[model samples]
Target chain A: MSTDTVETIRTTVPVGAQYAPGSLLDWSEALVPGDIVLDERVAPNAPWSAVVRAGDVLTIVDVGGNQSADCLMFNAHDTSERYSVPDTLTWQGNAYVREGTVLRSGLGRPLMTVVGNEIDRQDTIGGACSKESNTLRYGHHTAYQHGCRENFLAEASRHGLTSRDLVSNLNWFMNVPVEADGALGIVDGLSAPGRRVAIRADMDVLVIVSNCPQMNNPCNEFNPTPLRMIVTRNEDTVR
Target chain B: MVGARDTASVLAARADARAQGSNVSDWMPYLPAASSPFAPEGVDPSALVWAETVAPGGYTHKVVARGTRLRLEDVTGDACAHVLVFNALEPWERLNVADTQKIPWQAYLGAGHPLLSGEGRVLATVVADTSAHHDAFCGTSSDEWNVVKYGDAAPQGPSPSGRALLTLAGVKHGLTPRDLPPSVSFFQGVRVEDDGALAWQGSAGPGTYVDLVAEMPLIVLVANVPHPLDPRTDYVVGPLRVHAWRGDPSGPADEHYSASPERERAYLNTTDYLEARGL
Candidate 1:
């Protein structure tokens, strides 16, 4: 096949950001002047939430690599509508989230769309770790350890939400593969330092993230690391 | 009857009250009723292997052989049955709700849909469904959620949550809370609107049922509690009726087994595994 034919085959499905012709940094650096809006670094095992306005692109950077970013999204106008893993996976006809995947809500509406993704696959079914589950899986000693569930509770509380508001979340950069025997295994990640995935908000969305603090699994490679969050808008679409 | 007596005398009387016979009847299949009101066509009452009635906010777990048909009934209009399934041979191979939904490319589960595992095997098939209102998303309520809403959520309390009940049931089978994955809820429904809002659909009234035929040897856990999205203020729920009978696994001739390419492949995978083991 010709080079163009190969490129066509690769582009038929939305390729991961890493497979793009240019690096994420190269693409971001080419943006118009003054389009950058917010830039922040989240500490390991921390919780963060922000409102990424419609039309803005939120880029998540794996600063130290192999760290899982557990995330939940909600409509800024209506908390009743939030990300739905089943809807997202069913509509896409694929199990993993990748570029061009529309992050759908429980109502089957798009909340956000993946504009870029460095990781080849992202986990939507490997639920966030909880204190109770950690204790049950690892040991009672892990009961005292903070988990993604705690982080979500703390951050969601700031937005007037509670435990009932929590749902299965997306784990970016984490590797949880389903084996041939129907078992899910959380193995080492496929991400590396400086890898990035960018998603554009289809509507005003309240994005809650937990820099995973899991120490009992390879999800974080046993050591948590910091992450970078950058929001940028297209210059011509600036409002 | 023994008259009112001292504690020692009463204890001696109780010890002597034991039935003097072999306990073989306990293991024998006896027909409690002539027939099941909800049994599908051609299913004989004598084929029933087990029957149970789980009270509101109660739970139960059982291990059934492959092809066993389990019928779950909402005995009242307010019952919600949250169900989980695992491969009995390998507990780690449990139901994957995401694959169950995504593999069939259908988010709303109903009759003719196969419940899939993460490794792409069918654990069971929804052979029949009378209550079309089922939920494959928004798993059962948690203790924290129940406490926030009802002020109490102990497993044996007045208002028990499904998560707590399932956890307790899991312990009975040597499984733990970690073994339980996201479960499917029957009798309570949820629909997403055009603008992304979730609307709750309550039960389809008493007598509604769903039948699941196991495609593999399975450990099934069920907790009958109020759905988390249920809008009721008072913690009111009804009883669930469970009935199981021996049946044959879905073959290529079965409609559900050949419902879709995805389901067909899953059934094939299950057959391959079972055949290799001489099951």
Candidate 2:
């Protein structure tokens, strides 16, 4: 046998949950007692949307390991000013989104701020997968497969948004690294089961989430899983 | 397998044709000798390498050398020029619109801003701009959306979509549809309001133009199509005039090279790469 050895660089490993699905009542450690307002589990390859109130916290849980959650945000009052990847990345002077990063809007206003993070990084590039891109990247056989763009369209349509309203979005738990020569690659995720990140709404924002259904790339490890979303409101700050 | 003899004869004929000069004109560099009337001021007419007018709903692709300045003019008041840029040496390193907007710390692109790459290098710089109406947020129009808006969105049909046109342009360069990314649009504008609403600002007027100096060998693709946000019922657009001339790339001595710490780093990254390659 050859003396060469292959070394695998594993970025993510299974981690136990800090707050399991049935343990929301015990989340007083993070939020005040009885502050849990909404807790919903989004199925794999599904789309979820909700209006996260200003000052409220929305926690996203990677229930199943290596799931990519493609997300878009807009000002709840006016859907026109949406999440701006350029503003967010430029103002932060960083490519990856992490704890303490303020997600900015196209108007250069803060839409949400990451208060807690468990994963190493998040993606601001690596736009949501679409049928056209899927067909291009894979082949014509995948032209009709459901994609994140369709999920976004289906969810956004409920709010009266059209295809023209879609914008480049954020990818939580997705690992997209830019090489030294500026080659963008969507590789395996850096998120593990039970890992979570929490964001506080700086304004009343409409958050849309599409658990990425991309089976063509390693971003989902060829197997997508469900995600959990929990909204908590502080009693002391309730107006 | 069914027609082995015919296939062999066809291959022999193709080889014979290749041995001659029959395939010499398969693809030729677009090096036009004529000068353009719309060439911007300060551009030497003698140094111009290409000049052409792309019809409405048409597209064009060209690989320009480093330091080549490209001027795109809206001949009519309703034209939207959707453009994509890629490093000619390595097509994988294309324009990163997010980095382009963010690194400059300005969401609204104008003169003096550099189009950055994902690896923190300056691919091109907006040396001159008169049409302040440009968009870095919304990309080009899609075929499905175009079909919904118009009756048809075929690449050869009337009212061609920007994505379809760009795809064709990419195909001409041995690139597939996946090579196309979210592009930056010029001559049409969209601004976010105080209430977080995106407001569409149509073209400024005829003859409005924007100039870009390529900091690296770049494959630039442009599609002159109607803005997706345009509220017009008809697929109306105007022709786009393109002019390119040899120019000097920015260096450490340039004022824009040190405009900001971020920009300085990007410029340094670009220079370092070029120096390493002895280019």
Candidate 3:
């Protein structure tokens, strides 16, 4: 919450720096007006879930490049039916979800499909952190710090849901790769400022998101930042 | 199986860690340890503990004593019980995956493996596993999947989701979403190939089962469903039967302990804590 803590959110990389977020500025800069239904800015480490109707679109903007947006989805009509990581990978025949990939539910149905992506690939295997995990991975000092689990709990409670509803999540703009030795690494993201991903609701669905607050891993570069959620429809004409 | 020298080191390390504020590092050696297994003096599940069948789209949570043997048997094939465990006395201590894999150097959970807590304490051990390859990493089914695959919307033949069921059960225990940690999916199968890719497979058969013996008092939760990766087209998977009973105190060495020195050390650490507290 402090300026010093915020400063750690992102340290500008010089042009052509090894992982300088390249060309992400184009999406944010080139974006024109569309019928905006909902415009919300999520804080550095907050959880937000909403219903996105079929034919509607949800655009996630990385206001701060490298911020990881951990997400989970369910059929708005049936909370029991939710996202399936294995089906998405198996159906797409790929591990890392990317542009044009369909986000499948557990029964192998499409809940939403990625129509746009500024980040190259999203993480499905690497999971969100919790107080217990923070204590386990970083140390006891971090146990008191906020995490996605807490964010999800605070947000999900408003919907009458609890831990049983939590599942594997999608990490947009986060870079986690399985290594040659089969070891998993949470590395610094290739996403730059203004980089974004857009998903079209294939059916009415619930989208829950946690602007990850993890500072221990490279995913956020040890600094978490805010994100923007833009819900829009193609039929809505700009006034 | 814990050697005398091992017990001494466990005590010394724990004391040293406490003095230096140990939860800050990979103080695996200094993590909380369990006492000897709890052996129910005289308790019958059908009478004292618990015996119940979880129908489709349902789950349950209960606190049972150490030495409790949790028998999970699927009435039909392709059943999954997503489970999470916590130390009943100290709720803050819950299962931790990072240590489970790194400590025993096991990438895949198998019979004779200890389910670890954040502090590297033992939560449960897979003493018996008839379903050889239960999913260790993949999670459970969800709402969108149920609708997409079965056209069952919520509030009707609502899709079956282990996550949702777990939550409904968690509320009864006063556990919140923060307590909903990653779980061990039972009765499912997933295999990692030589190319570093993961493959999804179905369960063994009806009646396939696994038994978990708690090494300490445990708050256990179960989600009755199939793995999210289950290639079933139907939303309805299968029913599961859970039977809890007391275990043998003088039972042979912990399966995991006898299997490896690392695991034996883990048990020793648990014993050190129990002994120090004089439990």
Candidate 4:
């Protein structure tokens, strides 16, 4: 047996609430013409990940505005081939992401392209919060509070992920601006309720997300709320 | 199965090359440095494979072949060069320091230690170390950590993050976040107190450096930033200098390669891989 299997058995987390496909999310926020591959509501302060096939559209609905989702992507066939933020910024020449911007992989290829967006922009810098950071930023009392890192740990465990799997993530709906002197400011959010951002996968991409559960920062306004992930195939796909 | 097949085919190719009266790795393409921004004063560029200077809070990723020595220097004191190593051919098989420490019962990694991969392959060996210690536990600084420590005036973006830089570098190498493994923070020291609490300690001064020799073709991801446990009042920032050179030759009798039986096996795996590839 492989060493990875033994390690997985030692660290496997008990499964939590399970929801059927397309059962939790309402289709009102984003329109989907073809068959829905996956749809599930991600509770506030929780993490969820799924495989988004090439040609499929994954719509993330901020059902409650001002919520930031920490997201990461990996090539399904090769987990090592994953997303690159610096390359994305270099390829786009823009600090923030928007419609028409292609999310570049580590190998300088397009993993997904943002085809639709309802918000002004999403932060590529305001990283996801973790327990250690919560204690460092908020206070010692917040150390016990679960952050996106904990959520990712719980969710990624299903796919045999561990500490090595965690990466720098994208903070959707959060407002972080580069200052005049190259300083960064993580402050209030630009998204409100009902904001939806959609992307079309250019390859088989595995996406993991953490619904921001932060209570100390202004990203989520200290009140974490639930959201939905809707994955749909294109009209040309033979689903 | 794929790794085994590739290894076999590579070995066969090496044998074929030997039969042809030429070495397969004689054709390794190494872009020698014409101009390197990181070379120290009076150092000629001809001897260097590549050299690059990284700004404060910057990150970079590059691949180094076996027998390549990576030299990292802090231009100023109080900086950290967080490093992550990954298998260039098979990204899934990467350095696991936890295994490196657990198997050998070592607490700190320096000269004589082998960085092991998940599949028990030797990826690199520490050729030289100037610092008294380097931490394997502390990761990197983040947005909120900066906010709390430096207040709202803290520098933004993923500045001093080991994980973030590694992730960015991994993707650039056709890899992803899950490929980021625990890293080594050069020039940063941690001491476990009597109660088992880790206390920050002093590392090397400016102009000091540590060098590692790659045992396998591997990805080198570095974050030029401050240690997360650094209690400095000012947001610690410093320029970093990186120099790559041709490392000493590899063999079974190498000091690091012969450290232990397990390490010997891992080194053999690397040799099997390199020999088969004709490199």
> Which stretches in model 2 have alpha-carbon errors above 4 Å?
A1-59, A62-239, B1-31
Model 1 residue runs over 4 Å out of place are A1-239, B1-42
Interface RMSD to the true structure, each candidate: 12.8, 13.8, 5.9, 17.0
Worst 10 residues of 2 chain B by lDDT: B22-31
Q: What digit string (tens of lDDT, one per residue) describes model 1 on residues B95-163?
A: 777667545656677888888765457899999999988887667777656787799989889898787
**How far is B191's C-alpha from truth in model 1 (Å)?**
0.9
lDDT of 1 by residue, A103-193 (tens): 9875557888988888878777676776645543455556577788889999999999866467668998897665422335577999976
Kindly provide the TM-score of model 1 when superposed on the true structure, using C-alpha atoms. Answer: 0.59
What is the C-alpha RMSD, rounded to one decimal, of candidate 1?
14.1
lDDT (10s digit) by residue, model 2, range B1-279: 245333357787776556675232311223452445555577677899878778888888899999998888898788899998988887767777756764454667788789876545788999888899987756777665577779888889998888789989998998775466568899998775432334678889998999899999999999999987777979999888888889889877777878877687677678777889888
Q: How close to the true structure is residue B51 of candidate 1, measured as C-alpha lDDT?
A: 73
The CAPRI classification for model 4 reads as: incorrect
Candidate with more favorable, higher TM-score: 1 or 2: 1
- In model 3, how large is the Cα lDDT of residue B190? 68
Provide the TM-score of the second chain in candidate 1: 0.88
Lowest lDDT block of 10, candidate 4 chain B = B22-31
All candidates: CA RMSD (Å): 14.1, 16.5, 15.9, 17.4
Worst 10-residue lDDT window for candidate 2 chain A reads A23-32
Residue B29 lDDT in model 2?
A: 27
**Candidate achieving higher TM-score, 3 or 4:** 3
How many residue pairs collide in each prediction? Answer: 2, 1, 17, 12
